[model samples]
Target: MSLRQRPLQASNSTSRTTSEPPGQPTNPTQPNCHPSTPPRKGIRLNRILGRIVPIILLIYIAFAYDLVVVRYAHRHLYLQRRRTLLPIVWLLPAHGLFLWSLRAYLRVFFAHSPQYTNKSSGLISWLRTNFGAAFPDPDEAQQLEQQRLNTLATSLSNTEVKIELCQADGQPLRCWRDNCRARLKAFRMRHCGDCGTCRVGFDHHCAWFDNDVTAPATLRAFVAFLASIPPLYVIAFGPLFPSAWHTLKQIKDFTASDAVIRSKWYNKWYSWIGGPAFRWIVGYALRASRWPKPSKDRWPHESPRTPVLVALGAVFVFVATALAASSLTQLRRAMLTVDLERAKAYGKLRLQMEKLEKLTNGSDVEKLTAIRQKMETLSPTQYFKVSTKDKNSGEEKESIVALSPEEGLLSRGSAWANIGRFLGLKQASSSDGPAWLLSEPALRKILQAAALLPRENSN
Candidate 1:
C-alpha cells in the first residue's frame, strides 16, 4: 500500500526506546526522512499572486485606460483627437485575440483526460470517446494503480530486484522491498501521489493548470499552449502605452460631447451589466468627493493613468518573460520538470556514493555494506534480462542484469533523441517489445560506468 492508503494507528503503536542505534537519530522528523509542508499562509499568498494577481492587473489595465486616461484626457489633455484613439485601436484586437486563445487553452487544459494502462477500465473507454473527461474517479485510479503494481511485481523475481544495500549508520546489505525498480518492457509510468494516477513521462503537477502534465501524449500540446501565451502577453503589454496613445484621438472625439450612448440590441445585456460600474466611477469622480482620496489624480498633475498602466504592463511582461524562458528551456532539454529534477538527484546520489567510497577503507565489508544500504534508499534497482546466444549451439540464454539510477541511463539522452521521445516516438525492436531505452551512445557510456562500479563494490 502507498503512504496515502496507510491507516493511521494509535500514537503508542510504535514505541520509542532509548536503546536505539548509535550515530542514527531515532527522530522520525529528520530532514531526509520526512519532508515538511510549507507554511499555509505563504502557500495561500503565492497562489493569490500567481493566479489572482494577473487577473487583477488585466482588470486594472482596462479600467485605468478607459476611466482615467481616455475619459479624462478627452476633457482636459491637449493631444489631437485622432491621437486619443490609440489605446482603443491597440487594445481591441490584441485583447480580443488573447481572450480567444485563453478560452481555447482552457478548453484543452480541462477537457483533456489521460489514458491509463488498463484499457479494460470503463473510464478509459469513455475517455477515448470523450477526450474532455477531466480525470478518473479516485476509486478507479486506485484500482488501476493496484493492477499496475501487480503487473510490475509479477514480471520481476520475488516481486523485487535485490542489490547490495547499505546505509551510513552501519546498516547491513540486503534486498529491500522499496528498492525494487521496474524491469519489464513497459512504459515507466510513475505514480504521482498528488495527481492520484500513474502518468507516463510524469512531470510536475501544476497547480496553475490543476492537472497532471506529462510528456508522453500531452507534451506537444502542453508546450504549444505554453509557447502561445507568452507571445500574447508580449503583444498585449509590449505596446501597452503606444496602443493607448494611437487610439487616443478616436477616444477623445467619441467622448468630446456628452451625447447619450446606446448599445446594439445583441450587446445591450452586456452593456447593462458592465455600464453600472462605469457610471458609478464617473459620477463619483465628477462629484469631487474623491472616495479614494489622495488618489492618482492628486499626484503627478499629469495623466496618472500613463504611469499606472506602464507599471502594470511592466509587471506582466516580467512574469510572462520568466515563464517563456522556463518553458523554452524545458522544450530544448526535452525533459519534463520532474524528469529533469530526478536526473539532477541521480547525479547527486552518485556523487554521494563516490564520496562514501573515497572515505571508507577499500577492504572493509561492513563499510561497503553500509554504502549499499545508502544506495538502496536513494533510488530503485531493477534486474533486467540480457540475452546472449552461444555460437556453437545457436541457443539463446538470458542473464539478469541489475541496474539502478546510476547505471540505468534511460531517460537522459542526447537532446535531439530526448525530444523525439517527448514527441511520442517509440523505439521498439521486434526482440525487446516496448522497453524503455537510452540512445546507443548513452547506453555505451552507461555500460562503461557500470563496469567501474564493481571495482568500488569490491573495494
Candidate 2:
C-alpha cells in the first residue's frame, strides 16, 4: 500500500464486477499532492492576486465605460446627427456584449461553475443539482449547492450505499485527495488547492476570476466573456474607429510625428528600451499626448484621456483575444490546460527514454532502468483498489488494477463533438448519464485493450 492511502471502510455491498487484472495496481494516486498546491488558501500567488484582479478589472471597466460610452460614444459629436437613433444603434450590440461579458465575469466571481462533492454520487448529481438545465439561474444555484451537497452527504453518510468507482477497464478509479477518496471522479477531475474542492472538468484556477473554471458550467461563460471583447470594442467604438485607427497607424511608425504636434515623435527616450516594440509603445504615448482638437493648435491643453484609454483598452483586448484563442484551441483538442501541460511532460519523458535506449549500450543498464521507471511513472496507466465479495465463501477480497489513460481523456470522437461535449454545449438526455464520462463503447475498447472486461456470469 502507498503511504498516502488509508484503509477504506467495509461496505454491505457484495457485488464483484470483475475477476481479472483490473488494469494496473489500483492504489496509486495522482502526482499532484495537496501540499504541493496546498488544499487551502495557503498564501499562494493566485490566492493573493485573485481578490485584487477582479477589483482592478472592475475599475478598468468603469474607466473604459466612462471614456468610451460616457465621454466619446455618448457625446454630441456621434449622436448629434439628424438620425440620432441610427447613430446610437451601434451601442446596442456593444452594451449586449459588455453585459454578457459582465454576466460571465460575475459567474466566475461567484464560482457559478458546476461543482461536485467529493463523493461518488457527485458525478451524477452535479448535473441535476448544479447550475444547468434544471437550475438555470446561477445566482441562486451557486451558493446553495455546497449546503445542499453537505445535507446530501450527511443524509447518505451512514447508509449502506456502495461507493462504486470504475475506470475504463472496470477497475477502481481511486482519487487520493483527502476529501475525494470516496467520490466518483470524471476524467480530468482534479482538486483545486485554493478552492479546497475537487472540480470535474477542471480547467484552470483563474486568478483574474478569483475562482476555478470547471467545465459544463462556467467554462462556457469564461470563454464567452473573453471572446466577446473584440466585438464589444469594435461596436463600442463605431464613430471613433477612424480616429482610433489613425492613432494606431501613428503608433506603428515609431518616428512618424503628427504634423499638428510641435514636438517630433522621435525622442532619445524612446530608444531607452532599445527594442522596436518598446519604441513603438513610447511613440503611442507621445502621439496621444500630441493629439489635439481639429484646430490649428494641435497641442493638448489638458491630459489626453481618450488616447490613453484607447491604448489601454487595446492592450486588454489583445490579451483577451490571445487567451481566448489559446483556450479554444486546447478545448478543440479535447484537453484542458492541465491535460495539455501533462501531455507535454509525458511527451518529453517518452522522448528522453527513447533517446537513452538508442544511445546506451548493454553496460549502462542502470541508466536505462532509471529511464524506464520514469516512463512508467509518466504513463497514463494508474491504479485503484477495489473490494469484492466471493459468492461461495461470502468473504470480501481487495485487489488492484489499472485503467487506460484514453478512458480519462475521451479524445476518441470527432473533434467538434469532443469540444461540444467538454463544453456542455451538447444537449444531453437522461439516459446519456454524463458528458464528462466516456460512452460504453469507449469503455469497452479500453477494457479490451487490457483484456479485463467483466464476465456476464460474475454477478
Please give the CA lDDT of all the candidate structures. Answer: 0.42, 0.54
Give the lowest summed-lDDT range of ten residues in model 2.
Answer: 1-10
Candidate 2 TM-score versus the reference: 0.64
Residue 45 in candidate 1 has what lDDT?
Answer: 35
Alpha-carbon TM-score of each model against the true structure: 0.45, 0.64
Residues 1-459, candidate 2, lDDT per residue (tens digit)?
Answer: 011222222222322345553234543452322232223434688888998988888888887777666555554435443345654676777778888877767666655333333343654455334432221223233233333333333433332112223432344344554445444443445666666555656777888888777766677778888988788777775556556566555444523545532255354554646688776566656666555454432312112454556666778789999988898888776777766665677688778767877777445778767655555434454443344344455544443434555554356366676567656764531333344444444444433333234423535
How well is each residue in 1-459 modelled by candidate 1, as lDDT tens digits? 011111111112111212332345435542223332322232433344446644664586576546443453443332333455665665567667666655544533453444342443576455444443243333343344345333433433322211111222212222111221221112234545443344444555554445555655445445555555556656554644554454443334444432333222212455445477665344323332212333443322133345446555566556656765675477455445665555566567677667767776456666666544444433433333222333455444322334444553454545555555664456622322212233333333322333311123334
